[model samples]
Target: MSSQPSCSQTTPSSATQSIRPVSIKQLQTLGGASGDDDAL
Candidate 1:
């Protein structure tokens, strides 16, 4: 159904949103935002 696909898409969307900031923060902790793009 439509709801099934919406949920599937939203799950990854939410995860990516969470990871985007987390990745930057993690790289910042490791060193700096220099490798942020590469990390992603």
Candidate 2:
């Protein structure tokens, strides 16, 4: 699961650079759907 950290890092950076709204939405959905996984 070493690749998991890389994926987690890349996802937020890419999202921040590309789409703010989508990132916000994804975070919101993740927060609502899963409390623990929201750390991603």
Q: Give the number of the best model, judged by TM-score.
A: 1
User: What is the C-alpha lDDT profile of model 1 across 1-40, one tens digit per residue?
Assistant: 9999999999999999999999988877777455675688
Candidate 2 local Cα displacement, residue 18, angstroms = 0.3
Number of the top lDDT candidate: 1
| lDDT values for all models | 0.87, 0.86
- Evaluated against the true structure, the overall lDDT of model 2 is 0.86
User: What TM-score would candidate 1 get against the native?
Assistant: 0.66
Could you tell me how far off, in angstroms, the CA of residue 21 lies in candidate 2 after the best superposition?
A: 10
Instruction: For candidate 1, list the clashing residue pairs, or say none.
Output: none
Q: Least accurate stretch of 10 residues (summed lDDT) in model 1?
A: 29-38
Q: Write the per-residue lDDT of candidate 2 for residues 1-40, one digit (tens) a residue.
A: 9899999999999878789878889989887879765655
Residue 36 error, candidate 1, Å? 18
Find the 10 residues in a row with the least total lDDT in model 2. Answer: 31-40
How many pairs of residues collide in model 1? 0
